[model samples]
Target: MTANRTALVVRGGWEGHRPVEATDRFLPFLRENGFQVRVAETTEVYADADALATTDLIVQCVSMGEIVPEELEGLRAAVEAGTGLAGWHGGIVDSFRASSDYLQLVGGVFAAHPAVPADEAPAPGEEYFREHVIEITEAGRRHPITADLDDFTLRTEQYWVLTDLLNDVLATTTHPAEPGRPWRRPHESPAVWTREWGAGRVFVATPGHDPDVLDHPSVRTIIERGMLWAARGSG
Candidate 1:
């Protein structure tokens, strides 16, 4: 029999996490789970009018960049037509700052990352690098993606997003940069969240920062489950 699903992977932009490396790790997982995967290097895949019609899922690893309107529309239409879309880190949310339509569809956009200090700041080269301890929210406990996982931590980027359209938030991580300092504020960040866009499933994990980041057992498990759930009712 043919594979049960089709996953289209698009990787490009900022080479920090090595988008290709992440996609490399994801390919086997998809195939073992019975998905025939297609790999693309640009947003142009969405330019095809019939693109999403045959896609089971769209896995994007592209960082901040410009995308053509036709390409963006094709993607929008695909998801609206019931194709699953999944992404991690800045690739999805922080992408296309000029496109309000894209940002609205993604639910959240990256604002200032105060934790990442500026170069001319008093701290200079010093950065707020710490072990991210995440707490699974109440809604996460009922979801298959985070069902058995307990509170976990990872050495990765902790996203501080302004989002309100998520359906089920799978996990949250808090960053405490200071103690008792009035100017310092504690932030509760969302590490993983799932939402629905039109008739399709949208899953995003804002944790992947490097090759080893995904190596974390908890991190890997969550991403795996998110992929599956995002592809719900499709093949």
Candidate 2:
């Protein structure tokens, strides 16, 4: 018999690339690979007890907002008991900054958008959403989720995150400021990582800045395997 796996997908915040678009792309991918998927456009997952209890995985696509405490607790309970939690870009890690507990749960926060500078507003030319090559860090190559993948190009927001010494560094990319660019510095940053929280697992990739970018082979493979591994946990 095929094992039944369920995932609750929550999508919202920052309508730029459209969270729904990203969820739409992944929901079918999960279903095709043997998962029953449920989609929510709001933070309702943070409330419904029955919905939270039955899920085997939680996929968040939210950017930033306030989450209800009960819902947060419910998710915490479900995951701690072995449910998987996975997401990309701002939807998972950078979504809820107001809640310290939420930040603690997700493992990191948005430090800066290299494409979008601090002082200047994002105009047409100022944005860095072009196709760029991403070299997998040595650690990433060893991780099951990223192993076997080659260096690939993606047209997405390369996220620079501020972490608190807990994540298992899996992959990274370096950003050096150009002479004509907005800033003046070079920082080698972690692009992906995994961490364990109780009986559950968490995997994050900072490169899913756009929906189309998810179509790349290297990108899709990491996300799919990461989600599956995070859901299964030490299995």
Best by TM-score: 1
Model 2 Cα shift for residue 45 (angstroms) = 1.9
Clashing pairs in 1: none
Output the number of the lDDT-best candidate: 1
Residue-level lDDT of model 2, residues 78-97, one tens digit each, is 77777788998888877888
Model 2: residues with Cα > 4 Å off, grouped in runs: 1-3, 116-126, 130-132, 180-185
Where's the lowest-lDDT run of ten residues in candidate 2? 117-126
Evaluated against the true structure, the overall lDDT of model 2 is 0.77
How large is the C-alpha RMSD of every model relative to the true structure?
Answer: 3.2, 3.1
Candidate 1 wrongly placed segments (more than 4 Å): 116-128, 177-184, 232-235
